[model samples]
Target: MTAGDELSDATAEYITANDIEHVQIVGGTGAVSADVASALTTLGVDTVARVEGDSAAAVSVALAGLANDGCGDDLGLVSSDRVALVRGNPDGVVAAAVLASSLAGGYLVTPLVVGDTLPAWVRGCLAATPRNIGADRLNLGVVAVGGTAAVSEATMEAAPDAASSTDALTVRIGAATDTSRDGAINADDPVRPDTATAGTATAISATASPATGPVLSLCFSDAVTATDNVDRVRDVVEVNGIAAVVVNAAGNAGSVCDQSRIDVTLGQTLSAGDVISVDGSSIKLGTSADQRSFGSATATVTAPARDRVRPTISIVGIAGAATARSTFEIAFGDNVALAGTALLANDEVRIVGGPGGTSPAPAVSVAHEPGASAAVATVSRPLRPGDRLIVDPGAVEDGSGNQSAGTSGSAIRAQASPRINQVLMSDLKHTAHATWTVPTGSVAGVGGTGAGITIRAKGDGDAAGAAGNGWSMVFDRASTYSADKPLDIGVSVDPKGKRVTVRFNNGPATATLGDLIAALNGDDKFAALFSAGSPAALWRLPTMRPVLCWAWSRLATWLRASATPVAPSSPSR
Candidate 1:
């Protein structure tokens, strides 16, 4: 019976009358039941022949096998090389069955089931068999039938080799090779991958360290993956031939493929001097149609050496005078520049130590001229006295791209400036003791003995009752009480005018009676020259009145006495 669960009496009678001897079963057990077979056997039918397949595609392939085999050329006319590919779903398979069989009347057409990627089995079948023309490569064409999406682009790619190598594979949308909406097709530049076993490596570079995380870049001459994919650097590439030990496929290492460029992060930290080499064969460019191994064809650069030596600063300064805040200057001993776009001013410079030093000073920005030494930085807040500055190990680089070794500078102040507090005897004699704290900063650069002030001019007020008879101190370096409004600050003994002049510094218009008394007593020179009733004393000079007296805490005073109040070992810290 052509198709029936139960045969009609006429068909049975005809079968019996004709004395059918050999009955053949088609379409497997699903189409013809055992009962029917038994019935056939009972009807004296023997030597039953059956034809079936594991799946619809398999059955179609079997049908193709049974058809007349012929050598198909690149012509549109059908022959044996036609392949019928279906979607992986069951419905897609059953639906495409009729199209596979008809093929303008059962011409040898291959049927295949494929999903996301091209089926490996199909590639194996095609690559193993050469074209009927005996050519190593065949020109193939795909006539997509039924609804569109019947076969994937990858499957169509396999079609050219087996069907018509030079013909463009037709892309379809809705249904039928004819009248169906067309999908994108690049006739000028087909989807054919290059014949090279692997892509070529254009160049390789190493950035030992930068504001951004360190990375090694290996760029390729072709697209490696279907999309952008970045993972462990050691994945596609295995580091080799380098000075240091580098593991392959390290879980910690990372890499990304952005088309042709492969940015990599090695498992190990790259230091000042590292020679890196990537294995040429280890690169995963892509495999051939037959699932063969793939690697880079050639590497433009291998074993690129890392930066040598750390950067050093020649001149490092922060407005030490407390006059300048939020700004500092540093000049590298060698030609220097900032490195990496990822660098933030805050990342490059870290304020270490105190109120300003240890605090998280939000750096606004850092500006620098290429090859210039100093880089100016602006901060959100003002920099404090204890705020010390240091360079990040990798932020600053020399002309050669070597990273900075990292360094810390002293407090932002000129010289070891001191804050003094003294007490007087009130005996009208220059006899007093002083105490001061000298914060770390500034060396003995054109100033007092680092933190010491030398006493000059000796002897007490003259007994002759002159106005300026007392030995007085002179200003080593003239200074001002303030920068905004100029207030002269210094002490001088004018013997020609018979007067001792002193301009108080730092604050207030002038020195007071107590302040003058304290200065004279605080100095060893004043104590020796006008100690209670020594030659001439402040109270004993009836005709002489106290003159200008500048009290110095940090400033240096020139006098005849060789003694100083305080001596700080560290001029600057």
Candidate 2:
């Protein structure tokens, strides 16, 4: 008999007085309350049974057995190993059962959702027959049962050796969505199959741990219609005339946006809304001033989905050129993904209208700067004043798969600088000399007349190469000097290569100056060298160094004084 309330002593007594032969409980949790079970026993009604869950519903459909077991077309009558449900109102539950049974294949496996509005969908399904759903609509249904490791009776052993009666059953349920599910299923909800299993018994669960509720199941009739609702299907088991419902709790709930989600990688620890940039295959946070950013997301994600956006380019400044080497920077609109093959060369940049009748286009190398939404490109050739650069289409791409378009820019004038290619040393006619090759090219000296150059020789220790008097020598031709020209340094110009060579002569010494020569050649401090190119480039000799030139002068003096040794070793006599 169907009853909404619990059966008590009064109900039992009434049943006994009527001389009822047996009792069968249907619906309403699928099991009679313990009080009612005891009451019926006291009245001597031994034949008591319950049909709940899918089994109760299946009884009505299977009453007329099919000529063939697999011939039934309805989700209710079809043979399925498992069924998932979305619990709702009475009508919704009934409709869910009918829908599951009607659509269930040999095995109906689908994630279903039930909520206040699911009943209407069910009604629609009932109104329409012979309509087939796409395979994508229904998930393969699975029945998972879990609870405290403890069984209600000692008759059954625990499934695991370590299982204790106190152990709680926590089966991890996986969801199809990436977001976490929370507050969907409530406590003590029933979980059940939509139809009976092969054995004519429906699997069901009735107790949901109040602490951890079940994740809300998803139900959808079409792509446009879907819901994640608070509905539960009990995990039911009928054995020994006892209809048992296993408890299931834990429902996941969240609103899924139409856009996709992504993981984010940041240069620094992430904060909410921090900008993202591409650095090869990975992503990192961009600077606040960096306007170029793919998008923003929670710091937790290593990479997140964003609109496919292109990067914008801006010129920071131009450098190099005077020395035949140039460098420039291009700022991006935002930080981007630059991993894999994402970051590539901007082949569109070309140089035009530069001096020397050569392509002003700089041979450049590209690199992404960390924490900045900019890229640095270094050029191999010098830039002329009139040179202009044109960036054709497809110059660069951002991490988010955005490519830069064509643009144009003018090269700014830069000062010229002298570069020392290599140094040369020699001993010609007993005169130790050093020569420095400075290529000035089109770079003029200060005031545009000529490159002003200076060469000073200190005695390694003193201010000049000489010990007693002319310790330092100024090689500038413009400087005044005695006719003797005691200083042995000279500066000359090479007009052909547009080069300057400085010569330092230790003076004609008949005696060996090997030690001093070695010092002069080895010690960069042997001389102080300086130069000012037209525009002005700062450079120094790599091997030039400070040394004990004063000591060398002393040694030279001693060498000259001993040159007249009367009779060397006239005798250890």
Best by lDDT: 1
Q: What's the lDDT for residue 194 in model 2?
A: 22
Model 1 TM-score on a 0 to 1 scale: 0.21
What 10-residue stretch in candidate 1 is worst by lDDT?
Answer: 172-181
Candidate achieving the largest TM-score: 1
TM-score list, all predictions: 0.21, 0.20
RMSD of 1: 37.9
How displaced is residue 533 in candidate 1, in Å?
99
Q: Please report the TM-score between candidate 2 and the true structure.
A: 0.20
lDDT score at residue 511, model 1, on the 0-100 scale: 17
Could you give candidate 1's per-residue lDDT for residues 386-498 as a string of tens digits? Answer: 65567767666655667767676644455565533222122232222111112111111112222222121222333111222443333232343342332223444444543
Q: What is the lDDT of residue 207 in candidate 1?
A: 26
